[model samples]
Target: MPTALSSTDEPTPYAAPGRVAAARRAVGDVAILFQFRRHAVRRRHLARVLSLVFCAITLGAAAVPALCPGAGESVGTHAFDIRLLLPSAWAGILVLNMASAIASGGGRELISREEAAPYPVSPTTDHLGALVLAPLNIAWMVQAWILLGSVSYSMPGNRVVGSEILTLLWLVFSTSAAQVVAWAVEAVRRGAHGIAITRTLLVCLGAGAGAIQVSGNATHLLDQVPTRWFIVGAIDGWTWRWAASVAVLAVATVVAVALGAVPTHLAARRLPRDEARMETDQHAPRPMPRSVLGILIRTDRASVWRSVPMRRGVLVLAVGPGLVALAGDLKWSQMTILPGLVASGGALLFGVNAWCLDGRGALWRENLPAPATALFDARMLVLGEFLAVASLITVVVGGLRAGLPTSYQLAALLCTILVVTVQVVGGALRWSLAHPYPVNLRSARATPAPPAAMVGYSARLATSTTFTSLLFSGCAHVPDWRLPVIVALPCLLWSGLRLAGTRQRWQDPVTRARVVATVAA
Candidate 1:
């Protein structure tokens, strides 16, 4: 039995360092388990699993160079100069790390923040600790270790050791800076208005980046700078040069720590205080029409138009056409790619997660006397209409910019659009059935669909777009019969898409049950 005595007596046992460390580890392990459970229970568990497998493969590749003797030199030297490639690789990896963090819902755990708050850790330290332990950090650490191995492979003992130490230091600095960006974005996205403003700014910035990319001005500017200087300057055997490089790195790290710390503290401090707001302040919603198509349209409009991610996703679909029009020298063939890309992108944005948004409540629709297949068909119909309108706008704008197409060209363009639309719709529907994940309508940040789905859709779209563009580019060179064949195949395909989509979406009881369970919950 424990007895509380005087006021001077301690109320509880002090948490020892070992106990504290063990508790932190236990909490982290639980958090990881929770993430796995969350993904496992989703309809798209396979996609999430595949995504994890892919990341593991990537990390494995990075580790091989470091863990195996002479492997780095063998690969790095045979393919390219290790020294020359290291700096660029480091910079590229840093960008990749930040993108991954953003894509993976910033890979942050708010629970860690809450847990650490009562401890001796300050907000800044808590922020840094979260980042350092984050799964995303594994990628960058592998990159740093790979660099160290490359240096060890190419250099003598002292230089190798020095380079390794410097690489580790730089990795910390770069990753800390990335954490700042991630936390700040998370803070902004914690509010509806902030998400809208941030996403709009992002779209504007993306347009600017696209313009710069196409103009080749950035390449030209980069060429003017001697990028190899830092790599070459740092590892030179000269003691003074090495010392200067180390000094420069030290100064940079210090500056980076400051940069990362300030924003992190500010963002972390603001995050818990942010009161999430919804975008329900629309002008009185339009009255719902009686038809199935009308009901589907209303449901989707309310879901998408008010949501930040869906709205922004819709906005991004327009970017393809804008870029095509703004292109300095647009080829007729290149103009063909815009419609397919836009259609595919639009389909992917809402198609994959729409069913999941209705979670558990979907069973309510089953009781309405309308077959589940009808509901699915109605959804497809509504989505098809949206894609059709967007595709038409893109084609019209592109054709106008290209100057009115001749009869043959117009026919070819129309055929291309039809083919793309059918393929995109069919793919989206099939993919949606195969992989749906729960999404919260009320959440400030939109649900992050599995990375595998995003990558899979993008790759398929890019391949199809490229093939169509190249095919159309050579239309004048291809036999006349081929154009007629191309026109006929898509029309035939379009007619069967409905039957195919229906079969995939509603054919199996298992699939229906899973979707029903997901929707109802």
Candidate 2:
């Protein structure tokens, strides 16, 4: 070039008329925009909505104390445990470090633009950019923390703060599972069992350690203060508790870091390309079913059974929430949590699948011939099966452990009513939130859920109102179980109506679509 083009230089009008060049540029821009739109829809938009939700919940729940915390003096509690503070700070530091590492490794790109020209590309630069982005992610996390922190403070701050170590441990384990799964998949795909073996051994060691810890806990060695020990830490309570916690955390961290390495590598290798393969490859299952509910159930099953990674995820999700309830019952001797917490959590854990999963591929299959009733029926049946089994277990355990017969009777009726209502409404909402485009067979996520937000909101509102009405209308202060008729009536009526609604609505495409979009959203 006799005269190199500069930023100030405007290109001459196309004398040769390069149509292909113009077309290429236009196409590229469109592709980029589409990717950006999807990313924005999933990341920025979703994050904002979730953050807002958390803030609202926190504020609303906080105000509830002023409204009511029920009879009996509410004893506000707190403890200054320096030992805990140190570990908590350390855990936070670890979180920041992990966040930075992920950011540098291109996880941030999941929600950002590609690098422009003039930026030097190197390992150091990649890490630097990630670290820079870390602050943004940390900010979001801090907002989230504030939201949850408020809830914990209002409900159980000490427990929540102490539980940070546990939460972090679980998060680490989750990271490990995700990574272990990815590497296992990739390893299988690439015919490399070596990585798989390494992963398996690490997992086994972690499991073995867990068994030992559990045994120790059972024997009271894990929760008791160690005698004949020189204690230098800033806390009193129990050296045993701290020792067990630290050991558990250390094990979890090791496992998490070991597993996190794979996903990081995948991101570095290029996530966009890999993600496409994940979403649209022939290697995955062929299209499952067309109906929203059918799709959701199938997807849920697939997540648990199809891939080794998702299977692990399902186990954790299905089991993890109940862990605290179990510990509480064991310690408190008040099976208040048995049916109330475990049953509901397990059912909801399985039930929420209907909202997002059921709505998958709704657009493409809307015209496809599929039985609406069967779709809804099958999904509810499976979910109900799980709930029924858990509920039975909870009821039996709760009945035995409850100190008062009246409490047991009351709890049983309350639980029965709640489970029945949940079965039907949960089914309907799950089936209704189906989005058409970018039909995710997995259906656990919504890139662009169909627009039934209003209906879904109404469903939740109605459910809430019914619950409040049942409780407020002389039910809340019922110290003894007298009106079994009242409890049974509401429970039975709600359950019947819900089931009827699901049966009736499934056949109506418009109704189903509206519900799917709203519920899924």
Candidate 3:
């Protein structure tokens, strides 16, 4: 045992260089710590299994063309040469990645800043964590699938494998580069008048893109994009060129990863003025609602609109994919997919854990002299409205670019939007009641659920919504108008049954208490 020191004994001073070296050595350990904590807090066997299955599916999709080279060749003839569009596809994906990163405030966190406040986790760790979690977004995954499918279909037989490799490299490079840009954007947003400046910049960018499209220079501009070199190198099948491109992208990825930390450090040191302002704003009292349900609805709406994450998420969900559709000049058949994507993203914002939006206030809300069913209905109503507004905005934007749709196409699109919204709302409410998680959505980087659980939620939502969109897309081809209605009825009925079940469960005192206690914690 060591001898006890007197009051005169002083503590040893650590060398600055040694401390720095030690911190550098320990930076990566934070990821391991988060993983351990996550697994310990919740059993993730199911999430892991689902993740593996998804990976297998992604690989299988990519391998199809290689396994049977003649399969994609049998597809229907295209109106224009698909090869010329390859560069645009690549450039579009890169833009989307960057936009998503920026919108998400540098991507989702493995462990939120609030949760990690007691620890010594560094900004570098946060940057790494964000990079790791970036792939969980449904938009990112869907675009990646599209990229793979496009490359396999566009490239010649022998060059397909090499092109696919290059595409994968580009995906990695783009994601890393996007993270760097996102960190820089976050840093800027935390600066003076950051919100106004960022909003103005976004408007300018959108206006510029629109002007280019309107001027008929979209194709000419896309052809001149640097991404064309990747396709060209693949098509040429020149080993030296391919190797050089890979080497450059790899080195660039490393550079991006290192450069991202600088902004992360700067942003972390600064106060998030936008979030602070939103949280601290004083709202004047509104006139009282006649019914208890109306009061609850008002509160829920305010909760959603006030949250930084929800606002940013809604804006991104409303605009990002719609802009993509507009740029691509997607046909009515393709436009059917936009609503489902937007609705799913909207629901994931806070609906998946609806009660958590109230945080500890959920307990107070529950104690109010309101019927439990009224409370449930109010939450579901707000969620549905949120999803509907976001999805409708997306549809309206896409419609600007898509010329007049036939009656059948319009009917199919409308039914698809309504059905998908209902289905997503029902599923989200059911999940919220069945498996509630306490989430603080005040921060821009906060997810509505745990990262792993979000992965599962996003996967399920994406599958169902995508399948629904595809069905509606097919229905648009049919001349009969009643076909969409007939299909939508069953979907509505199924979702209604789900909502009824969730309501019944929520009405049970025991279940309600359990949910309230969990979320209020």
Candidate 4:
């Protein structure tokens, strides 16, 4: 000012060196928070992961009493085996986390195409931010809780700190490993290959691996040594061992980060080109099938086959029976429950997402002369056919495995079919009509149904399954009489409720329009 300096020529205050770094970190943190919000929008993903997390914690907590030392006894210095119970419970969680990450298009930064064009942050910073947030996923929390339970039951109060530190290191390693797998999968997707075939094969392999891990002691390989060492170290209060484990884990983490960086860099480069191309492709009009029923079936079927989220549900239907058969001792009680659970469970899942899967296509369907009931019914019809086929196969195979008579198997199959049909059609359609939501149908990226809708749908399925379970159990017992009545009562109740909901939704054009508009947007 003394020299009357020009506006651009004024001497600037020297920014503190630490302040610049801190400001950059703050920017990255905000960017990640925004990404997390967008990532959490899908209620379906959260529901599944939450349910599994609950189950894992429940199992771990339940095991604590059994595993804990008796009162007045010092915690054992000997190693404990988590392979017996914890692996199967936690494996499902790990698989779900990995699958969800891959479906959501990998563990890349949350910046959108518009913001990413200029790439405000360097790739190194962007990737680091993503890795930091990777563990923030609820799945990592599930793993953390499992470790906490393990440590609490195995180590005395004074030694818990070292155990917890070890647990944290393991969580970091697991999250980093899962992120690496996700990045690798995303890289594959962006590679020059048939997307469908590669993805389908990958899905199958993943499902198979997850099943093996869940149904068997596959995690024994990972858990056998460190788990034992950590338990022993915690019990012995060996701080040096804990420190050494942390050092090893740090080295491993650096290696994992380096390995993951390749894929991250590749995906980042590929994402812009692929996303731009996709944006162009999305602008084109899509062809609708002739009949309303055909449109419903084809559209839903295509989306299920093409999209990873829908495909995952479908895999549950297909893989569950085989898993049950292979894993079970094939006793009558177990087999009797298997068919109904698998059949009804699959239908319940399909129903949960039935209406939501329509996505932008809802706009086209809404303009049709047909009523909402017709649309709902058509969707149910497709689901019903699938259920019928899957249930039949499951019942027959399960019956054979359990050595049940043909007549009994038929009765079980018929009962399951009727019960699932009524339960899914009525409960699902009714809920769909009552609370319709939209999702991205065309994109292969996973989109979860709304949280409220998921909760409602889950409640409906649970109630329906309870009634249906009675009938299913009755069928399994091969009742000489009263099987028909067993099935018919719930069927009638479900159908009546379904009809009531359908009619209500059908009569509300405003709600229907809202659903369509929400989906289109």
Top-lDDT structure, candidate number: 3
Runs of candidate 1 with Cα error greater than 4 angstroms are: 1-179, 185-279, 320-330, 338-348, 385-414, 441-488, 491-495, 498-510
Encode model 4's per-residue lDDT on 1-521: one tens digit a residue.
Answer: 37654535645565323544744675665566556654656565655675676567645653453355541134343324432333343344456556556655565344434344553454545455556555443334445666567655545555656656665666666666667777777777777763665569877986775666566765455455334554455455667876777788778877776677677778766643334344455434468777767766775665454555445455555555655464554644344455445555554444655666766667777777876666766776776766666666665555454564555545655665666666566655655655555554333332235333343445456456656666566666664435645666767676777666675765687877766676566
Residue 275's lDDT in candidate 2: 33
lDDT of each: 0.57, 0.41, 0.83, 0.57
Worst 10 residues of 2 by lDDT: 227-236
Scanning candidate 4 in windows of ten residues, the lowest lDDT window is 71-80
Q: Give the alpha carbon lDDT tens digit for every residue of 197-270 in model 3.
A: 88899899999989999999987888899988877787777588888877887898878877888898999999
Best by TM-score: 3
Taking all chains together, each candidate's TM-score versus the true structure is 0.59, 0.46, 0.91, 0.63
The CA lDDT at 194 in model 3 is 88
Q: Model 3 scores what on Cα lDDT?
A: 0.83
Clashing pairs in 4: none
| Location of the lowest summed lDDT over 10 successive residues in candidate 1 | 271-280
Give model 1's TM-score versus the native structure.
0.59
Candidate ranking under TM-score, highest first, comes to: 3, 4, 1, 2
Show where candidate 3 strays beyond 4 Å.
Answer: 1-14, 18-23, 69-83, 156-158, 403-406
Candidates 1 and 3, the one with greater TM-score = 3
**Ten consecutive residues with minimal summed lDDT in candidate 3?**
71-80
